[model samples]
Target chain A: MIRAHGYAAQNAKSPLVPFTFERRDPGDHDVVIEILYCGICHSDIHQVRNEWGNSTYPMVPGHEIVGRVSARGKGVTKFREGDLVGVGCFVDSCRECGSCKEGEEQFCTGGATFTYNGTERDGKTPTFGGYSSVLVTNEDYVLRVPEGLDLAAVAPLLCAGITTYSPLRRWKASQGQRVGVVGLGGLGHMGVKFAASFGCEVTVISTSARKEADARRLGASHFLVSTDPSAMAKAMGSFDFILDTVSASHDINALLGLLRRDGTLVLVGAPDKPLEIAAMGLIFGRKTIAGSLIGGIRETQEMLDYCGEKGIVSDVEVIPMQQVDAAYDRTVKGDVRYRFSIDMKSLST
Target chain B: MIRAHGYAAQNAKSPLVPFTFERRDPGDHDVVIEILYCGICHSDIHQVRNEWGNSTYPMVPGHEIVGRVSARGKGVTKFREGDLVGVGCFVDSCRECGSCKEGEEQFCTGGATFTYNGTERDGKTPTFGGYSSVLVTNEDYVLRVPEGLDLAAVAPLLCAGITTYSPLRRWKASQGQRVGVVGLGGLGHMGVKFAASFGCEVTVISTSARKEADARRLGASHFLVSTDPSAMAKAMGSFDFILDTVSASHDINALLGLLRRDGTLVLVGAPDKPLEIAAMGLIFGRKTIAGSLIGGIRETQEMLDYCGEKGIVSDVEVIPMQQVDAAYDRTVKGDVRYRFSIDMKSLST
Candidate 1:
């Protein structure tokens, strides 16, 4: 076991504090990553606070991780020492499952081993995430982070980027299609960038009028203040597709009405409670409401490579590891510009 | 105007009574259909009792119409005298809309003229439906009823048949897919037949255990009682596509769970209220929930031709025109075998 030290939440109510832990020794096909910048995801807040009820205590939570390959076992062919890589939402999945075979391992029937607050393949070994110094995982599960982007900004791309990119790509969003990004936070900002990069005309729909400037600067062609009744009414049946990234519960019927005939609304954010959806809303226009998780390893790599080629990266505010608790509070309040990537170098201080 | 007589609902609470009405005379590009059989839809009850709150007084509710073209104007190119034809949920749609041009006239932005309880193109004239003795509609909105099948059984095909078939084909439920039909009534029965004919492995999901035998008889290979928790649990992620024909608000999250990764659940029936859905259920499997209205005129014609080739028709109980009130009552009670096709000749009584 390798000695590791980082920040962790001692319990559901307490904020994250510095803690020491142990990681499994790198074995064959395993690459140990020196996590440089770990993005504080909204899910991290959810899990650390036990809001999802499945969280384990003394939890070191951070999944959107970008780092350098520090060490590897002899069988690790995908990564060399010092090569840039990323660890996303999960660390392992049942490789034999049909979803794994289809390169959609996130939906593996045997259950995926999440990076933190989750059991590993051994079922007894609890996995600690990138809120720490290092990560040891199979080479197949590690993504090759592309060169030529702000490393800290690219951290959230592992989660926020893939979450938005997968749906737009899966839905066949192409040029001339009108796309709406519902919320201008972590996921929506990326959705705007990627959809615009894909040549789609992007619109950001948000309750806050202040997000309009950032939405436009993020490559969105239009901004629809969701709170304005007349604005929402005029935008009805306008968008071909809508990406809803708001985690807080909102009116989905209004969003459903914004889509044109046969249009789709994809939800990536998981609200704690069930939403009230009218079946007539979908039936009237032959519309759809679909949901997507943060993508598979193969798709993650594709998204990274595409990001490199398209000059796409998430808008992130880099914070010191010690400020993670404050960051969590801000994230909950939607205070950040987009996302927060924790600077791990501050952990030693 | 041509005189017509049929059973009509004077108001929301009243039963149907013998009433006289008038339809516009056949114009150029129009055909006068002498109604032979008209299927009673669950929506007929909704309209007659103002359940949808859009019913016009003295509403004659029936959209699943099949008859002979008794008269045609000189410019009628699509139909000839004495030809069998059908009229579905709508009588007219704005031809220039993108939805109409794409052969999805049901979603016309200009609003479609429903066959019953709706106003005609001129806006002032109220349109009566197929429960009346005759229907004068443009040839473009008329569907040619195929020969070699029981005409009465084909009546429901105009509404119930197309409603199910459209989504199945739209979602591309083809050979090798595992399909589940929820409910065993008008829409589900056809869903089973069409899914089975499409070479998909069809499963009937119903709350009633009594539907098992008839489900298999209707071409379903499997029966799943949705109320059986253990059975439902065992059948989790078992379907590639599910056609939800249930109008009552049910557990959509459970239905979403039945879909495999990327599987879809399409709704044809409109629940009066909004349904509760968990975003996590859909996100976990990347599943979809879509809704479809009835097919457009062109696609309805295609469906008719396909049914002709496949020898498929709804399992219908023929009722006299005067029995529509009873049929509507029974329909609400879920007592009909599949559909109730009204024998219009009984109107003379």
Candidate 2:
């Protein structure tokens, strides 16, 4: 067993506090990583507060993980000491499932083992996440972090980045195509950067007029205030695709109207309530509403390489490990520029 | 003007009554037809009773039409005198829009002229559907009713047939694929036939256990009662595509669960209220919920040709024009075996 230390919430209503735990001994295919940075995903808050109802207590919540390979078991061939890598929302999946065989481990039929607040395949061993000082993961689940990108900024790519990139790529967002990014938060910001870098005409649709400048700064070519009916009506049936990254409950039907015939509205954010969708909005135009999670490992690696080539990185606010509780509150208030990356080095203090 | 007689609903509360109307004389690009059979659609009842809240008074509701060309203007080359033809849903469309240019005239940006309860391109002339004794349509919008098929039984093919066929073709529901058909009604029955003939493993998912035998007779290899929790649970993630033909508001999430990874649930029927869909159901497996209206003219013709080759025609109960009112009530009660086709010749009596 390897001794590890990190912050954990003892219960649903409690703030995270420093705690000590033990990680499993490295197996033949395992690589031990020294955690470098961990990004705060909205899901972390949801799980910490038991908002999803299935959260386990004494949970160390973080999935947007980036680290250096500190050690590797004898059978691990993918990495050596000091190689930068990442572990996203999941750490293990049943490789025999159709989804896993196809390299889409995120949709594993046997249920992928989430980074935290979830049990291992044995159904007894609890898995701790990247909020800790070290992580032991199978080489198959590890992703090679591309060189020349800010390691801290790259952390969120494990979650927010791939969540947006997968849909854009799947839907074939490309040059001359009009793409709309709904909201300007963690996921939306990445959607804008990716869509723009892909040579698409990008528009940011948001209820906040104040996000216009920030959205433009993030590569959006146009800004449409969703609250303004005239603006929404004017842009109706103009977009080829719309990436809906808003996690808060909102009207999807209005967004459905902005897509042209055969267009799609891809949802990446997980809202608590079900969406209200008018059949006519989709039927008349033969439109689609689809959902995507963090991409497959192969696609995630492609996203990282693409980001490295395009010099695209998430706009993030770096915070000390001790300030995570404050960061969570601020995140709830939408104060972060885009994402919050915890400087794991502060854990040593 | 050509005098035509048919049944029309004068108001939302009124029953269909005998009424007289006029159709325009054949234009240079037009073909005039003597109506033979017109199939009763669920929408016909909805429109007559103003259930959709968009019905126009004195509306002649019918779109599933089969007829014989009585005359063709000088410039009409597609059909000649005595040629069997059919028209569905729309009489004309603005051929300039992107959807129209792509042969998806059903989604015409300038709005396709509906067969009834809608105005023509001029935005003033009311277009009467096949409920009348005669119809004048442009050559482009008319379809050739393939030989060796019962014309009366082919009426429903215009609406219900294309509505189901379009999605199956678009989604590539073909050989070796597992396709599920929800609701064993007009559209569902066609979906079963099309999918089965396309060489897919077809399953009929319905609330009633009694539909099992009928579904099997319609070429379904399997029948799963949707109302049975154990059956639904066992069939989870079992389908590649599900053609949802249910017009009534039902749980879309449950149907979504039956689809495999990257699967789709295509909705052809328009429910009155918005549907409730959980984002997790779609996001986790990269599933899609899409909508499809009736096919465009080109595809409709293709469907007709395909059906001709397969020796396929809708299972319909022929009725006199006077029985339309009673038929509408029976349709609402789900009492029809499959479809009701009105014999337009009864109008003259």
Candidate 3:
């Protein structure tokens, strides 16, 4: 067993504190990664606080992991010692399942293993995540961190970046298509960048007028303050696709009306309450409300390659590992420009 | 104007009382329909009781209309006197809209004229529906009822039949697909019949164990009692498409879990409360929830022609016009087998 150290929530109501655990020795197809950086996602907050009600205790919550491969077992052909690789939301899946065969292992019928707060296939091993010093994952589940990206900023690509990119790709956001991102936070910022890189006319829709500059700086061509009635009314039935990244409870139907006929509104954020959608909003325009998770391993590699080609990485505010608790508070208040990445090197203290 | 007398609601709290109204004189593009039968939809009841909160008082509520053309103006090219025709939920729409040009006139951006409880474009005329003896509609919106279908049973086709058919057609429910209908009411029964006729393996999912025999009798290849743990567990991760027809709020995420990867759940019923869907349900499986209104005139005619070819019609219990109030009560209690059609000839008294 390999000794590992990280920050973990001892219980649902407790703040994260330093903890230590052991990881299994590398198997034939395993690659041990020295996790260099870990991005703090909104879900990390949700699961650590047990706001979602299903979170396991002693949880080390981080899936957006970026690091260098330290060791590789005999059969680990995908990676070698000192190679840069990444591990996203999932670590292992039943390879025999139909979804795995179709390259959609994330939706494995036999249950894929999540990076944190999840039990392994044996149902006894509690999985630790990227908040720790190191991780050993199967070769198939690990992704290639493309060259030429700020490795700290690229950590969020595993979750926030792929979460936004997969939906935009699925919805066919392309040249000449009008795309709208409904927030300007971690996920929304990536959505704007990806959509713009895809040659789309990107627009940002936000209730806060202050996000306009941030949106523009992130490559959005237009910004519409959703609270402004005249602007909102003028932009109605204009967008071909809308990437909704707001995790709070709001009127989803009001945004559904802004979609053009046959348009789609892809949801990347998970809200606590049910969204109130009027039937007229969807039926009158033939619109759709769909949800998307992080990309599959193959697609995640594709997204990384594309982002690397476009020279894009998440806009991040890097913090030392000890400041994670403070970062959590700032994230809750929506104070960050985008995402927060923890420098795991600081954990040695 | 032509004098018309029929049963109408004076207000939200009023019952069916005798009322008088005027029908427009057959214009150059108009066809005067001599109403024979009208199907009672759950929507008609909702509108009458103001359950949807947008009711216009003194309303006539019916849209599934079947009739014979009594008069056609000199310039009416599509129909002549004595031709059988049907009119569904809509009466008119701006033909120049993108939706109209795409043959989806039901979603016209320029405001499609609803059959009843709605004001016309002129702003003062309260358009009456098939509850009356005659209705004057523009020839373009009138559908040609093909030969061989039982006329009374065909009335529901204008509304329920087209409503189910449009989505099935949109989703391409053909051979080698597993289609699940989630309820056995007016809409569910029609969905089963159509999906079965389309050569797909059809299954009916109902919370009530008693609906099994009826589901099988309606041509369903299988019946899954959703309340039965063993049955639902066995049916999970099996369906290619699920057409949800129940309007009352229920757990949509549970049903969404039953969908195969990339499957879709088309909503035909309009529930008042918004559906609380789990993000994992959609993202992991690439599933979708889409809503479809009733078909346009062109597709309604196509549906009528298809039903005519198959000798298919609704399982309806016909009643005299005076019993509409009682029928509405039974409908609210979910007592009807499938649908109720009012015999318009009884309205002469």
Candidate 4:
């Protein structure tokens, strides 16, 4: 066992504070990552506060982990000491399942071992996430953080980046396609950057008019104030794909109408309540509403490489480990410009 | 104007009774057909009762028309007098839109003219459908029904057939795929037959065990009682595609779990109420819930020709024109084997 320290919520109602736990020693196929930075995702807040009601006690909630591989077990060939690597939402899955075999371990048949507040496949050991000094994961699930990108910025790519990139890739949003990204928060920001980098004509949609300039600054070609009826009307039946990143529930039917016939709306943000979709919205235009999780390991690596080539990294605000609680509150208030990556070295103090 | 006789409801509360109307004269691009049979679709019931709340009074509702082309206007090129013809949902649309140009006029940007209860392009005239003995439509909207098919049995193909066929073709459901057809009514039965004909492994999913035999008889390779937990559990994460054809509010999210990762659930039915979908159902498996209306002119014609080649016809209960009210009642109660096709010869009395 290895001693580890992290910020954790002792209970759903408690604020995160200093906590200590033990991480398993590197197994034959394991690589120990010395956590360098951890990006806070909306899901981190959801889990820490038990907003989703499944939070385990003493939860170290973070998944967007970037670190240097500090140690590799004998059989681990993918990573060695000091190699930069990343881990996303899941740490392990039943690799024998068809989905896992096809490299989509996110939908593993036996259910995936989530980064935190989730029981491992053994059903006894609870997993801790990356808001800590280190993490131990099988080499198969570790991602090579491509060279030349800012490490803090790339941290969110494990979650926010892959969440948006998976759907854009699946929906084939590329050159000559009109892609609209809803919201301008963490996930939406990455969606805009990725869609633009993919050679698509990217439009940012937001309820507030203030995001127009910010959206354009992030490489979006156009920004539509979603609250503006005229702008909404003009965009109706226009986009080939719409990456909806808003986590709060709103009228998705209105967004559905904006899609061109046979166009798709890919959802990454999980709303607290069930989404009520009007049947006519889908039937009338032959529209589709799909949802995507973070990509599989192979795809995540591909996304990192793609981002490296395109010089696309998240626009992030770096915060010290001590400010995680404040960052969580700011994230809830939508105050962050994009993402907040915690400097884990601050935990040493 | 050409005079025609049909059954129509005077108002939302009134029962349909014998009525008289007139169709526009065949224009340069029009073809006039003497109706021989028309199938009863669930939408016909919804519109007659104003279930969707957009009905026009004294509405004559029917879109699935099979007939012989009685006359062609001067410039009509696709059809000649005495040609077997059919007309499905839409009668006209703005031909200049990308959707219309791509032969998906049902999603016309400038508004596709519906077959019935729709305000015509001229604004004053209300379009009527094929419940009448005669229908005059632009030549492009009329389908060329192939020879050797029972015209009565072929009527449902115009609506239900094209509705199921379009999505299967769009999703590229073909050989080696596992296709699940939900429900065994007019639209679902057609979905099963078409999927089977496409050389896919077809499974019929219905709430009642009573449908199993009928499903097998309709070329289904297997039948699963959807309400049976063991059966549904066995089918989890197995199907490549699931075609939902029930036009009533039901638990759609439960069915999403049945799809293989990256699989799609295509909806052809238009339920009156909003559907509640859990975002996790789509995200966890990378699944989609899409809706498709009936095919446009070109694809409807293709479906008809395919049915002709495969000797496929709907499992229809033929009835006299007078029994339409009872058929509508039975349809609402889920009492019909599949579809109800009205033999217009009964109106000759």
Interface RMSD of each: 0.6, 0.6, 1.8, 0.7
lDDT of 1 by residue, A178-266 (tens): 99999999999999999999999999999999888899999999999999999999999999999999889999999999999989999
Native contacts recovered by model 4: 0.87
TM-score of each: 0.98, 0.98, 0.92, 0.96
Q: Write the per-residue lDDT of candidate 3 for residues B63-137, one digit (tens) a residue.
A: 999999999988999998999999999898888988889888888878888999877768667888888889999
Model 3 chain B lowest lDDT segment of ten: B275-284
* Model 4: per-residue Cα lDDT over A1-349, one tens digit each: 9899999999988888999999999999999999999999989988888887787888998999999999989999888899999999999999999889999999888989999988788987999999999999999999998878899999999999999998999889999799999999999999999998889999998897888888999989998888888989988888999999998998899899889888999989888789999988998888999999888999999999898888888999999989988998999999999999999989997
**Please, what are the lDDT tens digits per residue for candidate 1 over residues B84-199?**
99999999988999998998999988889999898888887888998889999999999998888999999999999999999999999999899999999999999999999999
Residue A227 alpha-carbon offset, candidate 1, angstroms:
0.7
- CAPRI-style quality class for the chain A–B interface of candidate 2: high
Error of 2 at B34 (Å): 1.1
Q: Indicate the residue-level lDDT of A174 in model 4.
A: 93
Predictions in order: lDDT: 0.92, 0.93, 0.89, 0.91
Q: Pick the lDDT winner.
A: 2
Which tens-of-lDDT digit does each residue in A171-260 have in candidate 3?
899998999999899999999999999999999999999888889999999999888989988998999999999988776877887889
Q: Any residue pairs clashing in model 4, and if so which?
A: none
* DockQ head-to-head 2 vs 4, winner: 2
Q: Candidate 1 clashing pairs?
A: none
Candidate 1 vs 2: which has more lDDT: 2
List model 2 lDDT by residue over B11-103, tens digit each: 999999998988889999999999999999999998899887988878898999999999989999889899999999998999998889989
Evaluated against the true structure, the overall lDDT of model 3 is 0.89
Candidate numbers, best DockQ first, in rank order: 1, 2, 4, 3
